[model samples]
Target: MTGLAIAFLILSITIVWGGLVASILFLRSRPEPAEYPPGGVDDHREDIGPAERDT
Candidate 1:
């Protein structure tokens, strides 16, 4: 019974730590959100203004 309890404790700890590590890695890999102002442009473009372009 003692051996079984030790094994169960180790397994549960491993699972919990593994999930925590995976969640950290997953969230680290995602891009952050950038909200637009009210009634602002709802587009996803990297267009530079013609005059603002470096000659």
Candidate 2:
């Protein structure tokens, strides 16, 4: 491949792999929250919001 083509290929590879590595390291250091706030998917609170008023 031409020198310019090779350079662009390396640059693209570095960007993709670098981002992957950074994310892995970040998640490893600070994992996802085990417990989320209330009003999530399983929340059944009636006062959380208004009923089907269509406002």
Candidate 3:
């Protein structure tokens, strides 16, 4: 492959793999919340206050 093509290939691969590694590290450090809010999908907005919600 030409030099520019090789450079772009390397750049794309680095971006994809770098994002995967960064996300794994970030999630490992902060982790997801253990406890979800009381409501399931339909009523998941229970945590929002009435004044802030649209009618």
lDDT top scorer: 2
Candidate 1 residue spans exceeding 4 A from truth = 33-55
- For residues 1-55, write the lDDT of model 1, one tens digit per residue: 7999999999999999999999999888875547777545665554644355566
TM-score on alpha carbons, each prediction: 0.53, 0.62, 0.60
Compare candidates 1 and 3 on lDDT and give the better one.
3
lDDT of each: 0.78, 0.86, 0.84
Q: What is the alpha-carbon lDDT for the whole of candidate 2?
A: 0.86
Ranking by TM-score: 2, 3, 1
Which of the predicted structures, 1 or 3, would earn the higher TM-score when compared with the native? 3
User: For model 3, how does the per-residue alpha-carbon lDDT over 1-55 read when each residue is reduced to its tens digit?
Assistant: 9999999999999999999999999999989666666564455576676466566
Q: How badly does each model clash, as a count of residue pairs? A: 0, 0, 0
Candidate 3 lDDT: 0.84
Model 2: residue 26 alpha-carbon error in angstroms:
0.6
**Ten residues in sequence with the least summed lDDT for candidate 2:** 46-55
Query: Is candidate 2 or 3 superior in TM-score?
Result: 2
lDDT of 2 by residue, 25-53 (tens): 99998896676688665566756675676
